[model samples]
Target: MENDKKVIALAVRATRRREQLGGLVLVAPAVVFLLLIFVAPIALFAWRSVDNAEAWSALPRTRAVLRAWDGTGGPPEPAAAALVADVNSLDRSVAATLARRLNYSESGMRSMVIALHGLSLSLQKPVLEQLIALNPRWGEHRIWQVIDNESGRLTPYYLLRALDLQLRDGGLTKASDQDGTFRVIFARTFWISGIVTLLCLIVGFPVAYVLATAKGWLGRLLFIAVLLPFWTSVLVRTMSWILLLQQNGILNRFLIDHHLISAPLTLIYNRTGVYIAMVHVLLPFFVLPLYGVMLKVDRAQIWAAASLGARPLAVFRHSYLPQVMPGIVAGLVLVFVTAIGFYITPVLVGGGGDQMVSYFVAFYTNSSVNWGMAAALGTLLLIATFVCLGAFRRVMGTAAVSGR
Candidate 1:
């Protein structure tokens, strides 16, 4: 009997292992695809936020010597030889990358580095003296201070700049008011996203409720109309709005012809246009999830409350809001997070004052070739999104529990 039991147990174990192996095989492709497309890119973004390999890699000798010496006026005598060796060994392309990094601290630095490379052909005197002669800026304590601050492989410089601060005198300090560009952008991004989310909720919740509760054929037709926007491309929709909202465009022309206004309103290329375009695009995101949740709600309870002499507003506030709270939270998060990272809609419609963090991120990434700043901004935006979503969820959850 004991032998028979052991054989049964062995059979069960074998069967379980085969099932687990099959499940792994089925899941492997999806896991690999997600990691490659989503996880890998996000990891690279976060890594780039702190990665300062170019600084130490370009100035290996300088980094070594500077470790023991205190960061006072300037680096010691060997620092000059170390710098000369570092620059002489680098090709123009490599020197250009290092120059670009240095130029973040001091303008006109790329030209100086390029010129020094040109001077490398005629090294009559020490390269250090040549560097100073090439540009007096190279002899300044501030220039050396920038290099010393950026000697580490991993640095908080990108992150600091993202937050409108900088590392100076071995500690973090407020960057120049002029350099405090990012924080203002961050504030504007969140503020715009908040307004967009609120606008969407004001419009979407009623639309979702009506659609979810409407009668058969008309309901289906309305649903299709709601979903029609999804079929068209976002760019097309945005451009269409521009054509309609521009001065003397369809909307303004109609209003003028009808004598509703004396002149065309300043619509497109302003905050008004940004709000209109974004709300139009993002309304579906807020509505669909909420509509799905609303479909699952027990209409019987709402009617039961009404039958018991509950007012319409009371039925909605007391009976309706609690059940649909999850969907509302989901919709809010989806819209707000999406809105904060908006680029195309805002860029196409918004004025300079209305530009968000994404505009600068794209600028740093594509035009300026400043990946560090771009990565830092993107990562910080991601963190802010998560933090806001978490806080919203918590507050909504608490309200839900207490209301019930």
Candidate 2:
């Protein structure tokens, strides 16, 4: 009987192990799919922001020597000699590539480097003299510093430039006012996103409440109206706004005919247009999530609070607000995150100053062909989103604990 019991136990263990193995086998394909399609691409793009291989591609020996130097005085003779030898060995194409990389940090290096290749016949001259002879500007400390900064296997060049800073010998330096508009643009992006989120919350809270509590045909009709925008393309919605908001558009015409205004307003191609378009598009995002949460709310608690002699506002604050706060915070975060990444709507409706980080991101990717710059900007934007998400989570946690 004992032997029979042991045999039965062994069989059960085998069956359980087989089931577990089968479950893992079934999930393996999906895991691999997400890894390849989602994780790999994002990791590669983020890596591009720190990629600096092109900096010393044609001058490896010189970069190696520069990397070891203390960087106080002139670049070591070995580095200078290496530069001369490398320039002579490589063709103009390779030389031009390195020159372009260096010029990203400081201007004039392109012409100087391309010119140096033409003048490098002397293998006998002193290292500094040979380089100085080739180009007098090469003798400057700034030039050597630029080369040394770019000598690393990885760099902060793209990331720093995105923040409107430059890596220099003394440490990070603020970019000159003319070239340092990224910080202002970043601030503007946040400012616009905040306004849009606030507007969506104010408009959507009442609408979502109405939908959640409405009866029969009224509820269905309101739901259909809310979902209507999602069915239409974002571009179509934006163009519709353009047709309505442009000078002499429907809005101005209606107002003019009614004698509400004497003249057309400066609406399009400004901050006002951006706000109108963004609020309209984002209102649904705020409403739907809050609506779902509100549907789950027990109306009895609201009635119970009122019956306890609490005023209407007190009932709302103690009963209804606590229950729906999670959804409200979530919707606010979602709207803000979506608004900051907006590209087409802002570009179509807003003025030059109203353009956000996404505008510059597209510029770097498409027009300037600067993938590193684009990647850095995108990475920063992503970090901002994550930070906002963290803040939302914290607020929700505190609210849950305090019941406020």
Candidate 3:
């Protein structure tokens, strides 16, 4: 017995060591791949969002002047000359943007005007003194704040721009109406995604219920039909909706021939088109999860309710719906999360006004060269997704406790 015990302990140690080795070997490749592809790029791009200090780094003259200056005092003669020289070297428009960023900290930065005048002036040091004296506002802490803030190479300007806010004259404020703000775009994205998610739940719930209730070969056949869309690419499916929903497309032609309406009606490239495409694409997400949970429900409770003086509708309301509530919550979470991140379907079917937050994020990445703003928007979407998911889970948890 003693010998057998020793052998068993040795075997157990050997097995544990082997398992640990295998686990490390399995995870090492994925860790390396993620570090290279996902982790590295996210860190790099996050750094890019703060890369606004280029102006100060590029202009040594400006740095030299502002180096010794205190934050409370106005710019001295040397600092003023350095700033003028720095402004002259850059393009007027670029200079103006930099000045605006700096102006958030600096109260009386009239040097921006000199910079805007094509860097033409060769002002003496005393000229700056006179300029500040003429505009006594320059001597305040605000002017020094601007210079100090702009001294850094990286700024949070682009991130703020993406949110449609700007730092100006020592404070953050809403962006001008002229340069498109994100307020409307963000609201529309949420509204459209919400509507699409609700439609998916409404349309999919009945289908899932029917599929769940079916038995034998008939149930299997119905399940296959729901799963059929999985064989096609999302882009292909979206394009098919576009073809069918267009004014001259098959759907319109059928409606027109059947005299459903006066004209073919505008369906494609509008809000309605967006909804149709999104619902069609996302229906699968809703049905599959609901079907999974519905399959596990004990049908005895439902039939027992019907047997005990309860009507069919009452049995469903009191017993069947409660059984399927978990599935409904799961399906809603899945469909809403997927819909919120939709870009291709909305872009293909939605008009300029219908474009969502995804559209803006893509635009920033591809056309605007503003990754900071893109990251900011992506972060916002991620936060929104987590919040919704958390709420769904909490509600479901409460429902489960109440049911118990």
> What's the true lDDT of residue 254 in model 1?
97
Judged by lDDT relative to the true structure, which candidate is superior, 1 or 3?
A: 1
Residues 1-404 of candidate 3: C-alpha lDDT, one tens digit per residue: 99999999999999999999999999999999999999888677667666765556545786776767654445676666676667667776767666654543343354644433453443444757654655565455555555655676777666676677766565787765435567677778789888988999889999998998899999999998999888988899989998999999999899889999768878989999999989988898889878877888888998788789899889888998888887787777777888889999989988988999999899988997556677778766776887877787687885542222
Candidate 2 at 124: error in angstroms? 4.9
lDDT of 2 at 187: 91
Superposition error at 220 for model 1 (Å): 0.8
Candidate 1 — what's its lDDT? Answer: 0.86
User: Across residues 1-404, which tens digit of lDDT does each residue of candidate 1 receive?
Assistant: 99999999999999999999999999999999999999999999899999998877998988887777787875466676677677778898998888888777667777776665545534466645666777787777767777778878888888988998987777778875456688889999999999999999999999999999899998998899889999999899999999999997999999999999998999999999999999999999999888888988888999999999999999999998878987888888889989999999999999999999999999999998889999999999999988987787678875432222
TM-score of every candidate: 0.91, 0.92, 0.77
**C-alpha local distance difference test of each model:** 0.86, 0.87, 0.75
lDDT of 2 by residue, 1-404 (tens): 99999999999999999999999999999999999999899888888899987764777888888878888987677877777777777788888888888888888898887777866355676878766876798788888888888877888988998899997775989865436688888999999999999999999999999999899999999999999999998899999999999998999999999999999998999999999999999999899988988999988999898888999999989899988987788688779999999999999999999999999999999998888899899888888888877777686775532223
Candidates sorted on lDDT, descending: 2, 1, 3
Candidate 3: lDDT of 20? 100
